[model samples]
Target: MTMEIPIIEIKGVGPETAKDLEGLQIATVEDLFEHFPYRYENYEVRDLSTVKHDEKITVEGKVHSEPSLTFFNRKKSRLTVRVFIDRYLITAVIFNRSYLKKQLQIGETVTITGKWDQHRASIAVAEIKKGKEKRSRVIEPVYAVKGNVGVKQLRKIMSAAFAQYATQIVDALPEQLRTQYKLMDRVDALKAIHFPLDFRQVKQARRRLVYEELLLFQLRMQAFKMLQRREGKGSPIPVKKEDAASFISKLPFPLTQAQQRVMNEILSDLKKPYHMNRLLQGDVGSGKTVVAAIALFAVAKAGFQGALMVPTEILAEQHEVSLKALLEHEQVKVALLTSTVKGKRRRELTESLKNGEIDVLVGTHALIQDDVAFHNLGLVITDEQHRFGVVQRRTLSAKGNNPDVLHMTATPIPRTLAISAFGDMDVSTIDELPAGRKEIRTFWAKHDMLERVLTFVDAELQKGRQAYVICPLIEESDQLDVQNAIDVHGQLQHYFQKYNVGLMHGRLSPQEKEEVMVGFKENHTQILVSTTVVEVGVNVPNATVMVIYDAERFGLSQLHQLRGRVGRGSDQSYCVLIADAKSEVSQERMRIMTETGDGFKLSEHDLKLRGPGDFFGKKQSGLPEFKMADVVHDYRTLSVARDDAAALMHAEAFWKDDSYTALRHYLEQNGVFNKERLD
Candidate 1:
């Protein structure tokens, strides 16, 4: 059998260009074929009357005036071209195209295709071709590009690559799956992705590719789970009901039904011999911390050390304080390990952990550093698991051999994403808040409400309460000139002369930031003005008010998290969202926040509004980008894929089924296959 040459073998693609293509992970001809467009440019010709303002359109008309050129700099120039159609003179601006001035001859007809900006009051032509004998207009494909690479160049190279390697690309998916799913062949799908025959072809091709990607991902997760179960190496920690019950009895408040259900699930997982990897999900002030404390107690009863990793130093300190209070009478030894504990204290803590003197260690990423080692570690828990990458979580867990991993997140994710991201782990959700917890009163206000909001904050402060005034930016930029944290802090200091104002942002050093946070947490500061750095793990019960400036700039999920900072205490908390955006999508997002306090529901709505890109910021998660699948829109497909994966794995015949070799290979190639497969 002769193997086909990779896409790099294509002519005219030098080493530099090939490296650029490889940045997108397109190395082989097959890789290139699988690389799909992020979006399509529909250059279908339309009439001038059909061209809406601020929408991309393709129109053909006669040039009514000579093109004019304006120079911004030596390297920068803009050209304006005018065309007359339907008795309307439509002008198009070609930015950085001084050459277009010579090409656009007066009284000549040309077809232009590009985006229309009403602010510039012109249609900017991304591509200008002379109107000649043309068969049909091509709907250009727009791929995700990297440094110095533009859509035009990518399209040209991809077209050439496809023409040469299209024949060699084979369908990796089995024929049965393709036929059952009504999917197109690999070659046709690739061509349609880059140069679709029509809109219907684009849709169908997209469906086929998304299904394949999601199906493979699901299969990989299933395989990992199966492999783990087969190994059966989990340490069984016998749960004593009295141990958990006694701890809960000491609590000031009764456990909600939701918390009890989650506790039961955790207890069950601990009793099993298989290693437990579970996520404890809950809303703010839902008492997930107490559930975690119970789990830690159960692990401690089994004479195994447990570790809890948080994202920030302040959070680790906060957890230490809370946990110490909860487990005061327990025989388990608890120790705090953060970057802040330095010199002799840090050394002593590390020594205690290594010597098994500490039964439970709580800290941030410092706990997973090379210098830190745990003695007889058996269980690991992470708060705000989304903030830590998969590799970071794995590293922390690896401190103990196959430690039962428990992750907690207040950022409620939709079921589809949760399964997709953490499919191998069992999930326990604490959906109910504790009794006497009040819903945070939320409102959308404009700039005019600033004085009123400030007055309310002052009133709250008079009651010996604290408030959070969050700004979107840390500093003014040309792109974003919204109110910054430092500027806001200074202004607030002047506005409320009697109240102490503290400031914090990402720009501040870790120590400086921690100091400011401590001040706010201790109520030494009446008002804390900050940026999104407070988005995760900053808990202050007395902070009854959250005022977010330019709320429209934030995504719905983020807005929800920021709003969650309030409403943690018994006080009637309020969240004020200030934005001038009246756009439908923006308004809808803000409306969802005002209408519901359900983080999971808000996440689902946010998924619908912002799509999967904003759901978890997929780019930051190191997950492969989807070309066409809207994680929200194709959730049904994802569910189907998940079910199919489960069924296929459960079947007794799967182990011996040769037909699944391609899929197995696909999973292995993507680095998602279980390590047991190598054996």
Candidate 2:
């Protein structure tokens, strides 16, 4: 197959052009095929009078006069061509292309395709071709090019490459599978993707590509699941129904029905013969911690140690206090280990953990360190699962022998995405908030309403309720013109001099964060000014008001999380979003936040609005960056791909048949398929 053929081997790609293509990670023939269009331009013929400003169109016209050239600055030139089309006059502007003077002759019947600029009353020429169209309309692909590579130049190179080596492009999916899915042939898909006849063709091509991308990804995850099973045998820890009920009964508050259901699912997994890789998803104030504490208690009662890893030191500290208090009567010992626990204290914790003196250990990433060994590690629970990378989670689990792993994520992922991303794991959701939890009333307001908002917050403070003033940044940034927590803290302090104001951000030390949180939790601080650090694990029930400054800069999921901090208590809470965002997208995000408090629904909205890349940020959500597959937009296709992957994983043809060579080879080349551990 020509899949591995280097771009340099292609006919028009010289060393210079190859190096330029390399910038966009297109070094091989397969990469060229996978470089899908960022957008498409339809060259539908349009008359000058019918064309609107900012609309991209192709207009065929005769040059009315001799083309003129104007020099703008040194090394900069502009060419102006006036054209007569359908008894209407239109101006075409070309920049820095003095070499085009010869081809753009007077009275020449040329076709121009470009965006009409209303202000300049001219069209910025994207492309100009002499004569009329002899073929059907072409949907030109616009690629994410780099190194000054023109669209025409890249298209020409791709055309030549396809004409020469397309036949060698083997289909990664088997013929029967492709037929079952009714997908376009791999070669035809590549061709249509690069140079489609119409928008329908583009969709067809994308459907095939998206399916292939997602299928390969799912296959990879499935392979990982198989590898995990081969690693070691799991210890089936027994869970008594009475024990679980006792643990829940001992909690300060009764568990929600949803929490009880999720707890049952988790306990059932712990008792399975195979190791559990389950995801526990819940919204804010859903009592996920109480459920986790119950699981930890069950594990401890079964004569095994359990470890809980969180993202932040402060969160770990908070969990330790709560869990120890909840399980102290049960004789379950809980220990806290973080970076701050150093020297003699760290060694003592490690020794205690290794000697089974500590029934449960809670810490940050430090729990994965080599010295933190567990005598009988039965279960591993990671809070804020997205914050920790897959390797970090694996490292902690590796400390135990096939430990039942329960990943807890407050970030609600759409079910389709969760299936596509974490297909290997089972999922349990605490869909309902705890009983007595108040519904947070959300409001979107502009900066002009700040005075009234502050007054309202002051009133709330007088009523003995606390508030949170959240900012996007910690300190003033020269580049970003957004509200900073430090400045906002000072402003709020001055506004409400009688009420105490506390400051918190990611930059604060663990001890400092703990101190600030302690003040806010105890009501010593009437208003807590903070960054997104307070988004997770800080439960202050009396905080009835949440004022987020510059809320437009945040995503829907984040806004939902901030709103979650309030309404934890029985008091009716309010979340005020203050921003001057004028963009349609920003306005939509704010509107969604004000419309619903459901995290799962907000997450689905966020995924659809913001692509998965921006939604997950720089971290890997156990999902590969597909070249074309969109988790939200192509949700149906993703499901089909997942189903296909499951069937393939179970089929003997996928493993032993020679016809499946390409699929196996592709997976092997990408290191997606793992060799079974030789136990």
Candidate 3:
């Protein structure tokens, strides 16, 4: 393939237009080919008489009358055109698109796609083509354009580019793979994706491209895994079986079998010669911290220090309390170091940490500061691992000589995605909640049912139970109609006049947040109105009811986490999801939440409903975004890709086989073979 040809060479692209295309990353001919449509317009010919009201439809017709523009309001205008289709007249309305008035000429043939309005008997034009070309029913590609580049101009440019270079685009996948996966060739797939004659072609093209993308990603992950296995040795901290049992005996509660299994896995990893880079995945309220504390205790008993970095100050403080209580019998000194600790007290804690006087250090991002030195740091664990990136994790581990690093997350991801995203690390899941943990009964209600929900909350409070009123936004957003914590706090205070209401948001000072959380924890505040700030590790067993306002705005995993806050206690708990969601996707998300309390299932559902963006947050998941591949929808293909990559790698000789040369080169070009990433 002539991949290096510049996009500027394409017809209709001037210097200014090239700059606009560059904004969307269409630099070369290959990039233009890869610039898949964000969406498509269905331009299939349809009968106007059969069009449903408010349903988007496309039909070909001849302009029966000259277009006329009329002002509906001071700032709004509409362009109306009458068209004749099969001897029937239908009106097309172009609102705020008055510039099209001159283009809609009398007796001109055109094809238009828009919503059909049965009341006015008009078509609300969304898109229109000038000429009714002799083309079959097709889905027209809609490029993500900017500046002066309209969709029509971009389409013409893309058509010219494809004509000039389509045949030159060679298939990256080998013929054997293409046959094994039943994939269309690269050139055909690209052409069909950009300009498909039917939905069948779109499906074929998407399947082929999604498979290629997953195959490349799996290969890259496999390479990283191979590199990690060959990296430097780690500081080992082997523990005796009797010692581990003794450490567990000091716990306030017995560890669940799942927790015990994961702890054993961590212990075994520590005993290995190579460094331990493991992910500890557990659902909210699953007692992951207990297992983490056990691992830290083992490292401390082996005469080495451990550090646990969390995302929030309150969470860090909570962990400090829990760990101190759990390990005090062993005389392991636990220290808390956060940005809030200042003056001489901070210096004293730093000195203690440097001199090994502190056996375990738990804090927020403050643990990664340059001045924060450690004494024989053997294990480093980051709680709420998704909040921290790979570099941040590496910096903390760099504090020691290749310390055994354990990443802990309360948000559970599906097994396949976990394998895809964190293939570099070994994974252990604490699937079972601890014994005696009560499952929270979830309820879904619209805003109209708010009165009933508030009554239920009052009843729960009267029974000596606390409640949480979670709002989706910190402040009222001008764009979104979601409820805010501040406003909700004010309203709830007035509504529940007898109960104390507290407000919390991300904008609050650290001290302020701590004060509010402390108030809620001590039960002085009966109802805490807050944003998702308290979603992670704000454990209050006495809090038995969680009322989430505008719950439709939150992801399934977030909803699950919010529900976890209440179900921690043995007393019966309930999660009230107040959402007047109008979209089918939001309704489905709410329904799924009410049906099950499983975090893993919720996460899978969330991925399908919302894409991987909610889970990965764009680039932080440590994998580049695929142009066409969807992690949730194409998970089966992803597994197949992983299997194929493994098979190919195993068969290749010393990573230099002729069949693997193109794959290896692609990986290297994309920095998948970077030594630092491997390390």
Which number leads on TM-score?
Answer: 2
Model 1 residue-pair collision total: 1
- In model 1, which regions exceed 4 Å deviation? 1-4, 8-28, 35-169, 179-202, 224-234, 240-254, 330-333, 337-358, 365-375, 386-395, 423-426, 475-479, 582-584, 614-619, 646-652, 671-679
Q: Tell me the lDDT of model 1 at 265.
A: 90
List, residue by residue over 278-371, the lDDT tens digit for candidate 3: 9999998888888988888888888889999998888898899999988877888999999989999999999999999999999998999999
Candidate 2 yields a Cα-based lDDT of: 0.85
Give all TM-scores, in the order shown: 0.76, 0.86, 0.79
What tens digits encode model 2's per-residue C-alpha lDDT throughout 20-101?
A: 9999999999888888889988887876677777999888888887778888787899989888877877788998988777
Q: lDDT by residue for model 1 over 522-556, one digit each (tens)?
A: 98998999998898867899999999999988988
Could you list the CA RMSD of all candidates, in the order they appear? 6.2, 4.3, 5.5
lDDT value for model 1: 0.81
Ranking of all predicted structures according to TM-score, beginning with the best and ending with the worst = 2, 3, 1
Error of 3 at 622 (Å): 6.9
Q: Rate the local accuracy (lDDT) of all candidates.
A: 0.81, 0.85, 0.85
Residue 463 local lDDT, model 3: 97
